[model samples]
Target: MDIKLLVKLTSRAWALDILAHLHRGVPGRQATLLAATGAGRTAFGASLQHLMALGLVARNPGHGHPLRPEFILTAEGKAAAAKADAILRAAEVSAAGLLRKSWTVPVLALAARPQRFSGFKAGLGAITDRALSTSLQRLEAQDWVAREIDLSERVPFPVYRAVNAGGEISRVAEAAV
Candidate 1:
Protein backbone atom coordinates (compact mmCIF):
# COMPACT_ATOMS: atom_id res chain seq x y z
CA MET A 1 0.00 0.00 0.00
CA ASP A 2 1.03 3.61 -0.49
CA ILE A 3 2.36 5.53 2.49
CA LYS A 4 -0.53 8.01 2.45
CA LEU A 5 -3.15 5.27 2.47
CA LEU A 6 -1.22 3.33 5.09
CA VAL A 7 -1.07 6.44 7.23
CA LYS A 8 -4.80 6.98 6.82
CA LEU A 9 -5.48 3.35 7.70
CA THR A 10 -3.43 3.45 10.89
CA SER A 11 -4.51 6.90 12.02
CA ARG A 12 -7.86 5.81 13.42
CA ALA A 13 -8.23 3.51 16.39
CA TRP A 14 -9.34 -0.05 15.56
CA ALA A 15 -9.05 0.46 11.82
CA LEU A 16 -6.14 -1.94 11.39
CA ASP A 17 -7.73 -4.43 13.73
CA ILE A 18 -10.98 -4.30 11.80
CA LEU A 19 -9.24 -4.87 8.49
CA ALA A 20 -7.16 -7.73 9.89
CA HIS A 21 -10.21 -9.48 11.31
CA LEU A 22 -12.18 -9.10 8.12
CA HIS A 23 -9.25 -10.44 6.13
CA ARG A 24 -9.16 -13.44 8.43
CA GLY A 25 -12.67 -14.35 7.29
CA VAL A 26 -14.53 -13.08 10.29
CA PRO A 27 -18.06 -12.11 9.34
CA GLY A 28 -18.23 -8.40 8.52
CA ARG A 29 -21.16 -7.67 10.80
CA GLN A 30 -20.71 -4.95 13.38
CA ALA A 31 -21.07 -7.25 16.36
CA THR A 32 -18.88 -9.94 14.96
CA LEU A 33 -16.10 -7.53 14.04
CA LEU A 34 -16.40 -5.78 17.38
CA ALA A 35 -16.02 -9.09 19.18
CA ALA A 36 -13.11 -10.16 17.04
CA THR A 37 -11.21 -6.87 17.31
CA GLY A 38 -12.16 -6.19 20.94
CA ALA A 39 -12.86 -2.57 20.02
CA GLY A 40 -15.36 -0.39 21.81
CA ARG A 41 -18.58 0.24 19.92
CA THR A 42 -17.92 3.91 19.27
CA ALA A 43 -14.39 3.45 17.96
CA PHE A 44 -15.41 0.42 15.92
CA GLY A 45 -18.22 2.32 14.27
CA ALA A 46 -15.93 5.23 13.44
CA SER A 47 -13.29 2.95 11.97
CA LEU A 48 -15.92 1.12 9.92
CA GLN A 49 -17.17 4.41 8.59
CA HIS A 50 -13.64 5.47 7.77
CA LEU A 51 -13.09 2.29 5.78
CA MET A 52 -16.30 2.85 3.86
CA ALA A 53 -15.30 6.42 3.11
CA LEU A 54 -11.95 5.17 1.83
CA GLY A 55 -13.85 2.85 -0.50
CA LEU A 56 -12.12 -0.18 0.96
CA VAL A 57 -15.26 -1.60 2.53
CA ALA A 58 -18.95 -1.46 1.72
CA ARG A 59 -22.30 -2.59 3.02
CA ASN A 60 -23.72 -5.67 1.33
CA PRO A 61 -26.86 -4.77 -0.59
CA GLY A 62 -29.98 -6.91 -0.21
CA HIS A 63 -28.43 -8.77 2.65
CA GLY A 64 -29.16 -9.10 6.35
CA HIS A 65 -31.53 -7.17 8.59
CA PRO A 66 -31.79 -3.45 8.22
CA LEU A 67 -30.67 -3.08 11.80
CA ARG A 68 -27.91 -5.64 11.37
CA PRO A 69 -25.90 -4.80 8.30
CA GLU A 70 -23.23 -6.97 6.68
CA PHE A 71 -20.11 -5.46 5.15
CA ILE A 72 -17.83 -6.78 2.45
CA LEU A 73 -14.43 -5.81 1.10
CA THR A 74 -14.41 -4.02 -2.22
CA ALA A 75 -11.85 -5.14 -4.84
CA GLU A 76 -9.52 -2.50 -3.46
CA GLY A 77 -10.41 -3.52 0.06
CA LYS A 78 -9.45 -7.13 -0.54
CA ALA A 79 -5.95 -6.10 -1.53
CA ALA A 80 -5.75 -3.75 1.42
CA ALA A 81 -7.15 -6.39 3.73
CA ALA A 82 -4.61 -8.87 2.50
CA LYS A 83 -1.86 -6.38 3.29
CA ALA A 84 -3.43 -5.74 6.69
CA ASP A 85 -3.51 -9.45 7.44
CA ALA A 86 0.12 -9.84 6.45
CA ILE A 87 1.07 -6.92 8.67
CA LEU A 88 -0.91 -8.31 11.60
CA ARG A 89 0.69 -11.71 11.19
CA ALA A 90 4.12 -10.07 11.05
CA ALA A 91 3.51 -8.09 14.26
CA GLU A 92 3.69 -9.52 17.72
CA VAL A 93 0.43 -9.33 19.68
CA SER A 94 2.03 -6.78 22.00
CA ALA A 95 2.68 -4.56 19.00
CA ALA A 96 -1.01 -4.14 18.18
CA GLY A 97 -1.25 -0.90 20.11
CA LEU A 98 1.69 0.55 18.21
CA LEU A 99 0.07 -0.33 14.91
CA ARG A 100 -2.84 1.94 15.79
CA LYS A 101 -0.66 4.96 16.21
CA SER A 102 -0.62 7.49 13.35
CA TRP A 103 3.06 7.37 12.49
CA THR A 104 3.96 3.81 13.33
CA VAL A 105 3.20 2.05 10.04
CA PRO A 106 4.43 4.94 7.96
CA VAL A 107 7.62 5.11 9.92
CA LEU A 108 8.22 1.39 9.72
CA ALA A 109 7.41 1.35 6.05
CA LEU A 110 9.97 4.06 5.45
CA ALA A 111 12.54 2.28 7.59
CA ALA A 112 13.13 -0.38 4.97
CA ARG A 113 16.80 0.51 5.55
CA PRO A 114 18.68 2.39 8.21
CA GLN A 115 17.63 6.00 7.91
CA ARG A 116 18.32 9.20 9.79
CA PHE A 117 15.64 11.44 11.31
CA SER A 118 15.80 13.86 8.41
CA GLY A 119 15.26 11.01 5.96
CA PHE A 120 12.10 9.99 7.76
CA LYS A 121 10.88 13.57 7.95
CA ALA A 122 11.46 14.05 4.24
CA GLY A 123 9.89 10.71 3.31
CA LEU A 124 6.81 11.15 5.47
CA GLY A 125 6.45 14.80 4.41
CA ALA A 126 3.91 15.99 7.00
CA ILE A 127 5.29 14.17 10.04
CA THR A 128 6.65 16.46 12.71
CA ASP A 129 10.01 15.77 14.32
CA ARG A 130 8.48 14.97 17.71
CA ALA A 131 5.90 12.64 16.20
CA LEU A 132 8.57 10.83 14.20
CA SER A 133 10.79 10.60 17.26
CA THR A 134 7.99 9.20 19.37
CA SER A 135 7.02 6.68 16.71
CA LEU A 136 10.62 5.53 16.34
CA GLN A 137 10.99 5.24 20.11
CA ARG A 138 7.83 3.17 20.37
CA LEU A 139 8.92 0.88 17.57
CA GLU A 140 12.35 0.60 19.19
CA ALA A 141 10.77 -0.19 22.52
CA GLN A 142 8.86 -3.00 20.85
CA ASP A 143 12.19 -4.23 19.38
CA TRP A 144 10.66 -4.01 15.92
CA VAL A 145 13.16 -1.31 15.07
CA ALA A 146 16.82 -1.24 16.00
CA ARG A 147 18.79 1.96 16.43
CA GLU A 148 22.46 1.97 15.56
CA ILE A 149 24.92 4.71 16.12
CA ASP A 150 26.84 5.54 12.98
CA LEU A 151 30.31 6.81 13.80
CA SER A 152 31.66 6.87 10.29
CA GLU A 153 31.57 10.66 10.16
CA ARG A 154 32.99 13.39 12.41
CA VAL A 155 29.68 13.55 14.22
CA PRO A 156 27.92 10.35 15.17
CA PHE A 157 24.23 10.04 14.42
CA PRO A 158 21.58 7.41 14.98
CA VAL A 159 20.24 5.32 12.15
CA TYR A 160 17.00 3.39 12.43
CA ARG A 161 16.29 0.12 10.67
CA ALA A 162 13.24 -2.09 10.76
CA VAL A 163 14.22 -5.30 12.48
CA ASN A 164 12.35 -8.54 13.11
CA ALA A 165 8.60 -7.97 12.97
CA GLY A 166 9.14 -4.41 11.87
CA GLY A 167 11.21 -5.64 8.98
CA GLU A 168 8.46 -8.03 7.96
CA ILE A 169 5.87 -5.28 8.13
CA SER A 170 8.06 -2.97 6.07
CA ARG A 171 8.40 -5.62 3.42
CA VAL A 172 4.65 -6.05 3.30
CA ALA A 173 4.04 -2.31 3.12
CA GLU A 174 6.63 -1.89 0.38
CA ALA A 175 5.12 -4.69 -1.64
CA ALA A 176 3.11 -3.66 -4.70
CA VAL A 177 3.12 -0.02 -3.77
Candidate 2:
Protein backbone atom coordinates (compact mmCIF):
# COMPACT_ATOMS: atom_id res chain seq x y z
CA MET A 1 0.00 0.00 0.00
CA ASP A 2 1.14 3.52 -0.66
CA ILE A 3 2.07 5.10 2.62
CA LYS A 4 1.14 8.49 1.18
CA LEU A 5 -2.34 7.24 0.42
CA LEU A 6 -2.77 5.99 3.97
CA VAL A 7 -1.54 9.28 5.42
CA LYS A 8 -3.80 11.26 3.16
CA LEU A 9 -6.73 9.08 4.13
CA THR A 10 -6.13 9.40 7.87
CA SER A 11 -4.96 12.99 8.20
CA ARG A 12 -8.16 14.72 7.21
CA ALA A 13 -10.41 15.75 10.05
CA TRP A 14 -12.87 13.01 11.02
CA ALA A 15 -11.47 10.70 8.32
CA LEU A 16 -10.21 7.95 10.62
CA ASP A 17 -13.20 8.22 12.86
CA ILE A 18 -15.46 7.76 9.85
CA LEU A 19 -13.40 4.82 8.58
CA ALA A 20 -13.21 3.23 12.01
CA HIS A 21 -16.93 3.52 12.47
CA LEU A 22 -17.70 2.22 9.01
CA HIS A 23 -15.30 -0.69 9.49
CA ARG A 24 -17.94 -2.17 11.79
CA GLY A 25 -19.48 -3.66 8.61
CA VAL A 26 -22.92 -2.20 9.09
CA PRO A 27 -24.31 0.13 6.47
CA GLY A 28 -25.17 3.44 8.02
CA ARG A 29 -27.50 6.22 7.11
CA GLN A 30 -26.19 9.77 6.99
CA ALA A 31 -27.81 10.60 10.29
CA THR A 32 -26.49 7.45 11.93
CA LEU A 33 -22.97 8.10 10.77
CA LEU A 34 -23.16 11.72 11.82
CA ALA A 35 -24.34 10.69 15.27
CA ALA A 36 -21.76 7.94 15.59
CA THR A 37 -18.85 10.11 14.44
CA GLY A 38 -20.02 13.23 16.29
CA ALA A 39 -18.81 15.33 13.41
CA GLY A 40 -20.47 18.55 12.40
CA ARG A 41 -22.57 18.27 9.26
CA THR A 42 -20.06 20.16 7.15
CA ALA A 43 -17.10 18.09 8.25
CA PHE A 44 -19.00 14.84 7.92
CA GLY A 45 -20.13 15.73 4.44
CA ALA A 46 -16.62 16.69 3.45
CA SER A 47 -15.16 13.50 4.85
CA LEU A 48 -17.75 11.42 3.09
CA GLN A 49 -16.94 13.15 -0.16
CA HIS A 50 -13.25 12.58 0.38
CA LEU A 51 -13.70 8.89 1.15
CA MET A 52 -15.93 8.41 -1.85
CA ALA A 53 -13.35 10.13 -4.02
CA LEU A 54 -10.76 7.64 -2.78
CA GLY A 55 -13.13 4.76 -3.67
CA LEU A 56 -13.06 3.56 -0.05
CA VAL A 57 -16.75 4.18 0.44
CA ALA A 58 -19.88 4.29 -1.69
CA ARG A 59 -23.49 5.16 -1.41
CA ASN A 60 -25.84 2.21 -0.91
CA PRO A 61 -28.18 3.20 -3.69
CA GLY A 62 -30.62 0.41 -2.99
CA HIS A 63 -31.06 1.26 0.67
CA GLY A 64 -32.53 4.23 2.50
CA HIS A 65 -35.07 6.78 1.30
CA PRO A 66 -33.87 9.28 -1.27
CA LEU A 67 -33.89 12.01 1.33
CA ARG A 68 -31.66 9.99 3.68
CA PRO A 69 -28.73 8.35 1.97
CA GLU A 70 -26.95 5.24 3.22
CA PHE A 71 -23.35 4.29 2.75
CA ILE A 72 -21.27 1.12 2.70
CA LEU A 73 -17.62 0.24 2.22
CA THR A 74 -16.43 -0.70 -1.23
CA ALA A 75 -14.17 -3.73 -1.56
CA GLU A 76 -11.05 -1.53 -1.45
CA GLY A 77 -12.56 0.44 1.37
CA LYS A 78 -13.06 -2.69 3.43
CA ALA A 79 -9.45 -3.74 2.92
CA ALA A 80 -8.13 -0.30 3.80
CA ALA A 81 -10.35 0.01 6.84
CA ALA A 82 -9.28 -3.46 8.00
CA LYS A 83 -5.65 -2.41 7.81
CA ALA A 84 -6.46 0.79 9.67
CA ASP A 85 -8.27 -1.17 12.35
CA ALA A 86 -5.28 -3.44 12.78
CA ILE A 87 -2.90 -0.50 13.06
CA LEU A 88 -5.06 1.10 15.71
CA ARG A 89 -5.31 -2.15 17.65
CA ALA A 90 -1.56 -2.70 17.54
CA ALA A 91 -0.57 0.83 18.49
CA GLU A 92 0.66 1.54 22.00
CA VAL A 93 -1.04 4.84 21.41
CA SER A 94 -3.88 4.76 18.92
CA ALA A 95 -2.90 6.26 15.57
CA ALA A 96 -5.73 8.77 15.83
CA GLY A 97 -4.71 9.60 19.38
CA LEU A 98 -1.11 10.16 18.37
CA LEU A 99 -2.06 12.46 15.50
CA ARG A 100 -4.13 14.54 17.88
CA LYS A 101 -0.94 15.78 19.47
CA SER A 102 0.46 18.89 17.85
CA TRP A 103 3.69 18.41 15.89
CA THR A 104 3.68 14.65 16.40
CA VAL A 105 3.47 13.66 12.75
CA PRO A 106 5.95 16.28 11.56
CA VAL A 107 8.38 15.39 14.30
CA LEU A 108 8.08 11.71 13.50
CA ALA A 109 8.66 12.39 9.83
CA LEU A 110 11.86 14.32 10.53
CA ALA A 111 13.06 11.78 13.05
CA ALA A 112 12.90 9.16 10.32
CA ARG A 113 16.01 10.81 8.90
CA PRO A 114 17.85 10.60 12.27
CA GLN A 115 17.98 14.04 13.84
CA ARG A 116 19.42 15.62 16.94
CA PHE A 117 17.40 17.87 19.25
CA SER A 118 18.84 20.95 17.62
CA GLY A 119 18.02 19.59 14.21
CA PHE A 120 14.40 19.07 15.15
CA LYS A 121 14.14 22.57 16.57
CA ALA A 122 15.71 23.98 13.44
CA GLY A 123 13.59 21.93 11.06
CA LEU A 124 10.31 22.62 12.79
CA GLY A 125 10.72 26.25 13.63
CA ALA A 126 7.33 26.59 15.29
CA ILE A 127 7.71 23.73 17.75
CA THR A 128 8.74 24.70 21.28
CA ASP A 129 11.56 22.86 23.03
CA ARG A 130 9.21 21.40 25.57
CA ALA A 131 6.83 20.15 22.87
CA LEU A 132 9.67 18.64 20.86
CA SER A 133 11.09 16.96 23.95
CA THR A 134 7.71 15.59 24.88
CA SER A 135 7.03 14.29 21.38
CA LEU A 136 10.43 12.61 21.18
CA GLN A 137 10.00 11.03 24.59
CA ARG A 138 6.53 9.82 23.73
CA LEU A 139 7.75 8.30 20.48
CA GLU A 140 10.67 6.67 22.28
CA ALA A 141 8.39 5.22 24.92
CA GLN A 142 6.20 3.82 22.18
CA ASP A 143 9.29 2.17 20.63
CA TRP A 144 8.66 3.95 17.35
CA VAL A 145 11.83 5.97 17.76
CA ALA A 146 15.29 5.07 19.00
CA ARG A 147 17.64 7.44 20.79
CA GLU A 148 21.38 6.94 20.53
CA ILE A 149 24.43 8.78 21.82
CA ASP A 150 26.96 9.86 19.20
CA LEU A 151 30.20 8.88 20.88
CA SER A 152 32.19 9.48 17.71
CA GLU A 153 31.61 13.20 17.91
CA ARG A 154 33.81 15.43 20.10
CA VAL A 155 30.70 16.36 22.04
CA PRO A 156 28.42 13.37 22.25
CA PHE A 157 24.96 14.50 21.34
CA PRO A 158 21.83 12.41 21.40
CA VAL A 159 20.28 11.47 18.07
CA TYR A 160 16.78 10.23 17.45
CA ARG A 161 16.03 7.80 14.66
CA ALA A 162 12.74 6.33 13.56
CA VAL A 163 12.29 2.60 13.93
CA ASN A 164 10.27 0.56 11.45
CA ALA A 165 6.96 1.89 12.73
CA GLY A 166 8.17 5.46 12.62
CA GLY A 167 9.50 4.86 9.13
CA GLU A 168 6.07 3.64 8.15
CA ILE A 169 4.47 6.82 9.44
CA SER A 170 7.08 8.97 7.73
CA ARG A 171 6.42 7.25 4.46
CA VAL A 172 2.73 7.99 4.84
CA ALA A 173 3.35 11.62 5.62
CA GLU A 174 5.75 11.93 2.72
CA ALA A 175 3.15 10.57 0.36
CA ALA A 176 0.58 12.98 1.67
CA VAL A 177 2.89 15.90 0.97
Candidate 3:
Protein backbone atom coordinates (compact mmCIF):
# COMPACT_ATOMS: atom_id res chain seq x y z
CA MET A 1 0.00 0.00 0.00
CA ASP A 2 2.03 2.92 -1.22
CA ILE A 3 1.18 6.17 0.54
CA LYS A 4 0.97 7.96 -2.81
CA LEU A 5 -1.61 5.47 -4.00
CA LEU A 6 -3.76 6.13 -0.96
CA VAL A 7 -3.46 9.85 -1.46
CA LYS A 8 -4.30 9.51 -5.13
CA LEU A 9 -7.41 7.52 -4.28
CA THR A 10 -8.55 10.01 -1.66
CA SER A 11 -7.58 13.11 -3.58
CA ARG A 12 -9.93 12.54 -6.46
CA ALA A 13 -13.27 14.29 -6.13
CA TRP A 14 -15.98 11.93 -4.82
CA ALA A 15 -13.62 8.94 -4.99
CA LEU A 16 -13.97 8.00 -1.35
CA ASP A 17 -17.72 8.53 -1.48
CA ILE A 18 -17.94 6.10 -4.37
CA LEU A 19 -15.89 3.50 -2.50
CA ALA A 20 -17.89 3.98 0.69
CA HIS A 21 -21.17 3.61 -1.16
CA LEU A 22 -20.00 0.44 -2.83
CA HIS A 23 -18.83 -0.91 0.50
CA ARG A 24 -22.43 -0.85 1.70
CA GLY A 25 -23.14 -3.75 -0.72
CA VAL A 26 -26.18 -2.27 -2.35
CA PRO A 27 -26.88 -1.32 -5.98
CA GLY A 28 -23.70 -1.46 -8.01
CA ARG A 29 -25.15 0.07 -11.12
CA GLN A 30 -24.21 3.44 -12.57
CA ALA A 31 -27.48 5.21 -11.83
CA THR A 32 -27.72 3.98 -8.26
CA LEU A 33 -24.14 4.94 -7.53
CA LEU A 34 -24.66 8.36 -9.05
CA ALA A 35 -27.80 8.88 -6.96
CA ALA A 36 -26.12 7.58 -3.81
CA THR A 37 -22.95 9.59 -4.26
CA GLY A 38 -24.59 12.64 -5.87
CA ALA A 39 -21.77 12.81 -8.35
CA GLY A 40 -22.31 14.00 -11.87
CA ARG A 41 -21.65 11.70 -14.83
CA THR A 42 -18.18 13.01 -15.60
CA ALA A 43 -16.88 12.75 -12.06
CA PHE A 44 -18.40 9.35 -11.52
CA GLY A 45 -17.07 8.04 -14.82
CA ALA A 46 -13.61 9.33 -14.10
CA SER A 47 -13.61 7.85 -10.62
CA LEU A 48 -14.86 4.50 -11.84
CA GLN A 49 -12.16 4.44 -14.48
CA HIS A 50 -9.53 5.35 -11.92
CA LEU A 51 -10.73 2.58 -9.59
CA MET A 52 -10.68 0.10 -12.42
CA ALA A 53 -7.18 1.18 -13.38
CA LEU A 54 -6.11 0.46 -9.82
CA GLY A 55 -7.91 -2.92 -9.95
CA LEU A 56 -10.15 -1.82 -7.08
CA VAL A 57 -13.32 -2.06 -9.13
CA ALA A 58 -14.51 -3.70 -12.33
CA ARG A 59 -17.48 -3.83 -14.61
CA ASN A 60 -19.68 -6.92 -14.38
CA PRO A 61 -19.40 -8.57 -17.77
CA GLY A 62 -22.56 -8.42 -19.87
CA HIS A 63 -24.44 -6.91 -16.94
CA GLY A 64 -25.62 -3.71 -18.59
CA HIS A 65 -25.37 -1.54 -21.65
CA PRO A 66 -21.81 -0.64 -22.54
CA LEU A 67 -22.82 2.99 -22.16
CA ARG A 68 -24.27 2.29 -18.70
CA PRO A 69 -22.31 -0.45 -17.01
CA GLU A 70 -22.74 -2.23 -13.69
CA PHE A 71 -19.79 -2.41 -11.38
CA ILE A 72 -18.39 -4.68 -8.67
CA LEU A 73 -15.42 -4.58 -6.36
CA THR A 74 -12.54 -6.78 -7.25
CA ALA A 75 -10.88 -8.76 -4.46
CA GLU A 76 -8.31 -6.03 -3.88
CA GLY A 77 -11.06 -3.44 -4.11
CA LYS A 78 -13.04 -5.18 -1.39
CA ALA A 79 -10.09 -5.02 0.96
CA ALA A 80 -9.45 -1.37 0.17
CA ALA A 81 -13.11 -0.53 0.45
CA ALA A 82 -13.24 -2.31 3.78
CA LYS A 83 -10.41 -0.15 4.99
CA ALA A 84 -12.21 2.94 3.69
CA ASP A 85 -15.38 1.85 5.47
CA ALA A 86 -13.46 1.31 8.67
CA ILE A 87 -11.89 4.76 8.38
CA LEU A 88 -15.29 6.41 8.01
CA ARG A 89 -16.90 4.36 10.79
CA ALA A 90 -14.10 5.06 13.24
CA ALA A 91 -13.77 8.76 12.45
CA GLU A 92 -17.47 9.50 12.11
CA VAL A 93 -16.68 11.77 9.19
CA SER A 94 -17.86 11.49 5.64
CA ALA A 95 -15.09 10.29 3.32
CA ALA A 96 -15.95 12.99 0.81
CA GLY A 97 -15.85 15.75 3.38
CA LEU A 98 -12.66 14.47 5.01
CA LEU A 99 -10.68 14.25 1.80
CA ARG A 100 -12.02 17.48 0.31
CA LYS A 101 -10.45 19.62 2.97
CA SER A 102 -6.96 20.68 1.93
CA TRP A 103 -5.18 20.20 5.22
CA THR A 104 -7.14 17.38 6.81
CA VAL A 105 -4.97 14.45 5.70
CA PRO A 106 -1.69 16.28 6.19
CA VAL A 107 -2.70 17.38 9.66
CA LEU A 108 -3.66 13.82 10.46
CA ALA A 109 -0.24 12.68 9.29
CA LEU A 110 1.50 15.25 11.47
CA ALA A 111 -0.65 14.45 14.46
CA ALA A 112 0.18 10.80 14.07
CA ARG A 113 3.71 11.71 15.06
CA PRO A 114 2.66 13.81 18.10
CA GLN A 115 3.20 17.53 17.74
CA ARG A 116 2.24 20.83 19.29
CA PHE A 117 -0.01 23.35 17.59
CA SER A 118 2.94 25.42 16.42
CA GLY A 119 4.66 22.40 15.00
CA PHE A 120 1.63 21.44 13.01
CA LYS A 121 1.26 24.93 11.63
CA ALA A 122 4.95 25.06 10.78
CA GLY A 123 4.99 21.68 9.15
CA LEU A 124 2.04 22.55 6.96
CA GLY A 125 3.64 25.86 5.96
CA ALA A 126 1.53 28.85 4.87
CA ILE A 127 -1.59 27.53 6.57
CA THR A 128 -3.25 30.17 8.74
CA ASP A 129 -3.70 29.67 12.47
CA ARG A 130 -7.46 29.55 12.07
CA ALA A 131 -7.27 26.80 9.44
CA LEU A 132 -4.91 24.67 11.53
CA SER A 133 -7.08 25.18 14.60
CA THR A 134 -10.21 24.25 12.72
CA SER A 135 -8.66 21.11 11.21
CA LEU A 136 -7.39 19.95 14.61
CA GLN A 137 -10.75 20.63 16.25
CA ARG A 138 -12.54 18.62 13.59
CA LEU A 139 -10.19 15.65 14.06
CA GLU A 140 -10.50 15.93 17.84
CA ALA A 141 -14.28 16.08 17.66
CA GLN A 142 -14.21 12.90 15.64
CA ASP A 143 -12.04 11.28 18.33
CA TRP A 144 -9.33 10.71 15.72
CA VAL A 145 -6.94 13.06 17.50
CA ALA A 146 -6.05 13.38 21.17
CA ARG A 147 -4.91 16.65 22.62
CA GLU A 148 -2.92 16.90 25.81
CA ILE A 149 -1.61 19.77 27.87
CA ASP A 150 2.12 19.79 28.40
CA LEU A 151 2.91 21.26 31.82
CA SER A 152 6.59 20.61 32.07
CA GLU A 153 7.42 24.19 31.22
CA ARG A 154 6.39 27.22 33.26
CA VAL A 155 3.53 27.81 30.87
CA PRO A 156 1.64 24.80 29.61
CA PHE A 157 1.14 24.11 25.94
CA PRO A 158 -1.05 21.66 24.12
CA VAL A 159 0.15 18.76 21.97
CA TYR A 160 -1.83 16.64 19.60
CA ARG A 161 -1.43 12.99 18.64
CA ALA A 162 -3.37 10.64 16.41
CA VAL A 163 -5.77 8.25 18.07
CA ASN A 164 -6.44 4.85 16.56
CA ALA A 165 -8.63 6.20 13.83
CA GLY A 166 -6.19 8.97 13.04
CA GLY A 167 -3.37 6.47 13.02
CA GLU A 168 -5.24 4.39 10.48
CA ILE A 169 -5.79 7.44 8.36
CA SER A 170 -2.13 8.31 8.71
CA ARG A 171 -1.11 4.85 7.61
CA VAL A 172 -3.36 5.11 4.58
CA ALA A 173 -2.04 8.53 3.71
CA GLU A 174 1.59 7.58 4.29
CA ALA A 175 1.27 4.54 2.07
CA ALA A 176 -0.23 6.63 -0.69
CA VAL A 177 2.37 9.37 -0.57
Task: Return the top candidate by lDDT.
Answer: 1
> In model 2, which residue pairs have backbone atoms overlapping below 3 Å?
none
lDDT per residue as tens, model 1, 17-129: 88888889999898999999988899889999999999999999998799999999999999999988888788888767878888888898889878999999988888888
Kindly report the root-mean-square deviation of model 2 from the true structure over all alpha carbons.
Answer: 5.7
> Per TM-score, what order, best first?
1, 3, 2
Q: What is the C-alpha lDDT of each candidate?
A: 0.87, 0.72, 0.75
Q: Which is the winner by TM-score between candidate 2 and candidate 3?
A: 3
Ranking by lDDT: 1, 3, 2
* lDDT of model 2 at position 78: 83
Tell me the spans in candidate 1 whose CA falls farther than 4 Å from its real position. Answer: none
Error of 3 at 30 (Å): 1.2
**In candidate 2, what are the lDDT values of residues 1-177, reduced to their tens digit?**
454565457546766667767897545788888887778999788888888999898888788888888888889888777665554444445455675455666676677678899998887676688988998998888778899999998989999987867767665454333
Each candidate: RMSD = 1.4, 5.7, 4.9
